[model samples]
Target: MSCHVLYGIAGSIAAYKAPEIVRQLKKSGYSVTCILTKSAEKFVSRFTLENVSEEKCYTDKEFWREQNIHIHLTRKSDILLMAPVTANTVSKCAHGIADNLLLNCFLSFKGPVIMAPAMHAEMFENVAIQDNISLLKDRGVYIAGPIEGELLSQDLGVGRMIEPETLVECLSVARFPALSLKNKKILISSGGTTESLDPVRVITNKSTGQLGKALSNMAHLYSADVTMISAGDVSSIGFKYQIEKTASGMHDALHHSIKSHDVLVMTAAISDFIPEYSEKKIRRKDNALSVSFKASSDILKSLSEQKKERVFIGCCLADEDTLIETAIQKCKEKNCDYIIANTASNFGNSKRDFTVVSKEKELDSYSGVSVQEMAYRILSLV
Candidate 1:
């Protein structure tokens, strides 16, 4: 079934991003109803929203219609998404002030509520706004960013709307907690580890930790206790991190925490080999140098001691011909519940196309899937 999303946009420079939010949701097969504050019209026009969302954009006048707009919307919406939520509206909603159709719908809706704040740096940093945000959070509203960056004030600070991709990811995570990972412990390792060869150089893969962060965010949305062991800085913020600079360190971190979590997702592109290192930086010299290399133990192979039935999901990079076979083999070898065989074509792309397999055989395959959707699928499998 398609999720019904009532998207509310407030008065902020970030309102310009509203259309893309709607578009992405629709692309993900969501039914969206847009609500706009009167002041929001100054930045984003109704015509634009209507075109993008393919639904009527409601305003304060909606309540005057024969139908009770708020009640109607409340009954239909599965999630109330307030994006680019200005500080003004944040204060209003926090105080139970239903001055507009959006707030009216907000109060009437009983489902999940997701608010992404966007405003001037000064306005966001104001004590009143911070308190209001806290109040909303206390009321069980999921709060996204207001990430720190260039604000509408032409100054850098903690007041920029999070990107549409992140907002979309957050919305998906918030909308469906039915597959609630409530009380389940998730230990995830993400990003690519770098092995130091010298002070000036190291070996690392192109892995950016995008999928790991997505999975963690989804797990968090479902109320799971998540601990991420990252190879370096992860893309998503707000997760507890255990940073490891080398493949050996990453192996140790996972080995230590593997027992505590119900699920383990190994997405880090760890170095297969590490070179013997010199304590001092290799100086530029006339003589050519050759460093001896040694194979590193595979992290997944060492999971034999884990108790049976612990869910393990692993990702492998390989060619199409060997993909499914490799995934199935690895699944059995590592005792993984499921495995994803991703081809080289999607190395750094926003969308991933891969085959999902179990130890015995191929279960399913997904193509052209967003990282957000990827997170959703993995959770469903779990």
Candidate 2:
């Protein structure tokens, strides 16, 4: 089915760029409908937007009489986009202010919404905007960026709207989330599992969990249900990491919660060993401390043995020998259908050089792609 995207423009100096966004969406084979806030029209003329969109721009109190445009448009769109979303409009959206045609549609509609915020650095940094952004995220609203770069005015800082192409990439249905596992369910495990050594210390790995989260998000976009279980707090701040707890209690919680999911993509760098005797509180008297550790339960192997019908995918990152051999061995030992193998040094980096090893195929490689693309490719494979 062809995708239809509703573009909402708010008041901002960046409004002038809205037409280009519409044009790009159209070029990408999306049916585009543009909605203009009254404030936005002041910055970019309706004539320009209407001319580019080739569709009537709605922005009036008499919206219903003018062809019941709001409902009709809402029913037709697959996604809603708010570009150059100003601080004022974001606050209004956060607080459920349906004072305008654009806001009214946003409040009443049920569809994926993406926002690309633009404003002064100070206003964007305001607590209110931050709270609103968080609120929107909780509601499953996707945000492209207020990516940092030079601003329209002289001052250099963040809050500039992301370029149209980047926005298109996020919304693009044509080229992403590689083909193998599209429309398939994928579960991912990320970060290093912490084994409490003492109250203050834990045994953990250097894993940053970037690979797993990237894979999770990409699988999600490809119409797969994704569950991410991490041993550490992953946030997007550095590598789009989000803080997630990995305490023993939390692990149990996740284990109990998982149901009849089909695919389990295990990329998490789980600790194989834990302290033989962990104290509830800190052990203070330090005198050449020696702690013995026993191997923890093999989560992937156990799951593979228990769930025979599901597809189990594993990751093996090695530093010494040829990665393909290690990945194949790991795949066989773990009873996984596929293994994504790469160098340990490639972890937490922008570019990924990895190979896909499955029972049916010897090797297929992907590299020099964003962690996101790497994820998409992996998901496509199944």
TM-score each candidate: 0.69, 0.56
> Candidate 1 has what TM-score?
0.69
Q: List residue ranges in candidate 1 displaced over 4 A.
A: 1-79, 83-100, 107-113, 117-165, 172-178, 235-237, 283-289
Model-by-model lDDT, in order?
0.82, 0.72
Give the runs in model 2 whose Cα sits over 4 Å from its true position. 1-36, 39-183, 234-258, 280-287
Candidate 2 accuracy as lDDT: 0.72
lDDT of 1 at 307: 35
* Each model's backbone clash number: 0, 17
Candidate 2 least-lDDT 10 residues: 234-243
